[model samples]
Target: MGMEYQLFYWPSIQGRGEFVRLALEEAGVAYLDVARTKGGMENMLAALKADAHPSLAPPFLKAGDETIGQTANILLFLGARHGLAPRRAQGRLWAHQLQLTIADLVSEVHDTHHPVGIALYYEDQKKEAKRRAEEFIASRVPKFFGYFERMLTRPEHRGVYLLGARLSYVDLSMFQMIEGLRYAFPNAMARLEPGYPGLHKLHAHVAARANIARYLASPRRIPFNEEGIFRHYPELDEPAA
Candidate 1:
């Protein structure tokens, strides 16, 4: 149970796979980031076509024989096993809910750079991307951030973590959300961040966690770039008036 996971993800970008990586790192469990190794892309392709449970993409987690697909589903599994989530049904469900919402936010973030389709380059759809990104910065960003801020500032929560008393996978995902958004939309974040102090606080808290801080400092952490879901484009991230 100590070193029992093989995470198959693209060698390059942090992408969605990073959420699982952060969770595993924080749990202090050893996991092979399979695709990061030599000949690992082939291994990842093999994993995608496995007979019993084939996933059409990367970011699948291999937990023993079981291949957990999708970011939220993997976290749902990991949270239960690693005490990153609560034991009780209501609390566990709440953590899962937050993770799912974060997933949605990630999708919206991706669309900022690929509004028309994933197959096209950002330049190919640059016009659509600008429109999408502008709306995202003006509307969707606030919508998602506001919801999370309210969750953090809720009465029982007292603005510490998403699930109130303890740190959960949801909080880890929140850290990624802030990091990715800030990377992709720096000007927007600078303008909007002061309003969501709780989220920024949560991001800092997660960053300062012993394992996560180490991971961020290490070579294992993939640098953000145009290839990833969170791409930095000043054209796309038009500054607010």
Candidate 2:
């Protein structure tokens, strides 16, 4: 029988939840996508408010009596349980390091539109978003992508994935990042793609994974839109190359 893992996240936006979802799907693990289910968001909220421990922002996991929060932490827990994480001490730490880096990039992506404050709306903060988006497109995106590209191209682990041979949760998160960035900044990504062949290849390879392909085709995966973290505003994108 498959393990029972319950995921709690916001229903509307993919955001950080996509990272956990991707890992679950790729691992072929049967799990409950709680918030996406009927009345799931309400249940998630109740669970959060009731907990004595410090609750996470979103995308948490529950296994039996235990509840854990944060995207990277959830992924780490699942990775070790499902044998997706490396057994070696160094490899395990590296996987976590990669995951944390992805988390940082995800936050930067969110901040591009809501840099001033999360309490404010995009329409209310359009001016700040434009300025933040400029910095994001010009510097942040390239810096993060360049780092991952270099990691993948490292001589010690020079194959397809960050860990050379294995397909870890980090690989899935990178694919999601690439997808989100392409949607959020199409023009910038088009020009930037040429410089990060490793990332491009990684994106392509992950897309071809059977489970990922199925998840992409299925209604379970929400399409990118204005409401999500990675939103596509033509103004935010750079000029087409």
The residue pairs found clashing in candidate 2 are none
Which digits, one per residue and each the tens of the lDDT, describe model 2 over residues 100-217? 9988999899998888999998888888899999999889988998899899888776569878777889999999999999999988988889999998998899999999999999
Q: In candidate 1, what residue range of length 10 has the lowest lDDT sum?
A: 156-165
Q: What are the clash counts of all predictions, listed in order?
A: 0, 0
Scanning candidate 2 in windows of ten residues, the lowest lDDT window is 51-60
lDDT of 1: 0.90
Once model 1 is optimally superposed onto the true structure by TM-score, how far is the C-alpha of residue 18 displaced, in angstroms? 0.5
Model 1 clash tally, residue pairs: 0
Off by over 4 Å in 1: none
lDDT of each: 0.90, 0.87
Per-residue CA lDDT of model 1 for 1-241, tens digit only, reads 3659999999999999999999999999989998988898999998788637877787899888898888899999999999999999998998898899999999999998898988877889999999999899899989999999998887776547888768999999999989998888888888999999999889999999999999999999999998988999988876655
Off by over 4 Å in 2: 1-3, 52-54
The per-residue C-alpha lDDT of model 1 at residue 232 equals: 93
